[model samples]
Target: MKNILQVVHFPQGAVEDIRFIKSTNMPYAATGDLFISCNTSDIDANNGGYLIARLDKNFLNGIPTSLSWFNVVWAKGYAKAVHPWDVTNQGEVYYVSGESHGYDWSAMYCLNSQGKRRPVSNWRTHWLKNGTEWKGTPASANPFGQIDSVNYSGIVFKITGRCELRSWNMADFSSVQSDGNGGTRKGKWPADFLFNSPCDPQNPSANSPGYTGYSPEACCPVWGLAVLQLIEGIIMYTWE
Candidate 1:
């Protein structure tokens, strides 16, 4: 008889959810290793982290057994409060954080099987109101203030590797305006503008050159009715 029972228990001090490694070509996946993401009993203890372990296939009498070869991939404060993440067939873990902690806050990054930050030199294409263009590192881009979800798919060409990262989040940003004189006034835009066209962070004008009718209502609501208010859209970022 084949084992069909699944275990729903998390390792001690770990909570949230778990994802099984589905890498068909990786050694770890063949060994039945699983990926687990959790927050410790004390949120302040380890910040946020995940584990990789293997479940006993024996399932003695249908009772799930303890995990083996458990490896906790701690992210210190970098991946604080893990949100949504996915793993590749090559054993690479890609995740988006939930908290803010400097540059790496609310950003996406990867970790090798051994729990080390992998250098991502993939080509990133940005879709903006101005036009699609190549930009800097996508790891710390944090285009959206707080990322809510992330999905990754990897492809290997000979020795070179590439992947596509798709994510969505509630978009929010700050707005600045001149005080009429030589001074400037600053305010924040509501977090409901998800697909609004890009605007100059420092000096914003809704009717600017690249205005694609997708920009915020005249930079500030006081100027006109908010265009994309309370409207959320899926903005995917692909890294090849």
Candidate 2:
């Protein structure tokens, strides 16, 4: 594997995780590029933020052509999802959970190419137990269930140690269900949803770079069965 990009922050910068965004509808970054979720030198002023590493075919020495940085106004750390939404007046949305920074809440945030940030509350989240509305999971109550961690593509999957694979409909942030025929149809949250083991649900996966244990697969439900089968095969072989 070749190192395609490298980010260096002087004095104090901790690179947490990295994601690649495909072509999007955003004006500033219309092409595909790389993004990073990391802690800058100043946490209070540059805490929960991400770096846009514009990839260039000609920029030499494995470096990004340019970098644009933005931080979530109130996020301390541990942010995920930098997906581009066609709506939102030309902006991208991301989710930040307090789980990493020692807070018990998760939320979706939006950012424009101009570095403007805002907390969004457009989710129809009665799917949560207490039926909390957006601006995120209710502070301290987390009606949806404890989110050990979350992964996002077009939809967000909340993975927990309880052997759960809860999904949130991103199309409208409403409730959704598998049609029992491998397709998704409208359904209420908690109800109409299927429950199954996403991993050794007993072994909650950690995303740390140095972590070297059983990592649960973070895949869309469309291929969930295949991933589960592969993981089970690994587990069974290891046990044998």
Choose the strongest candidate by TM-score.
1
Best by lDDT: 1
- Each prediction's TM-score versus the true structure: 0.36, 0.33
RMSD of each: 15.5, 14.0
Model 1 weakest 10-residue run by lDDT: 222-231
**Model 1 compared with the native: what TM-score?**
0.36
Off by over 4 Å in 1: 1-12, 16-33, 39-41, 44-82, 100-104, 123-210, 215-240
Root mean square deviation (Cα) for candidate 2? 14.0
Positional deviation of residue 5's Cα in model 2 after best superposition, in angstroms = 10
| Pairs that clash in candidate 1 | none
lDDT of 2 by residue, 26-138 (tens): 45743443443333223544434444332232233345544455444323333323321111223353333222323233333344455443322332222333433322333
Give candidate 1's error at residue 56 in angstroms. Answer: 9.9
Runs of candidate 2 with Cα error greater than 4 angstroms are 1-34, 39-66, 72-91, 100-103, 119-121, 124-178, 182-187, 190-240
**lDDT of every predicted structure (CA atoms):** 0.36, 0.32
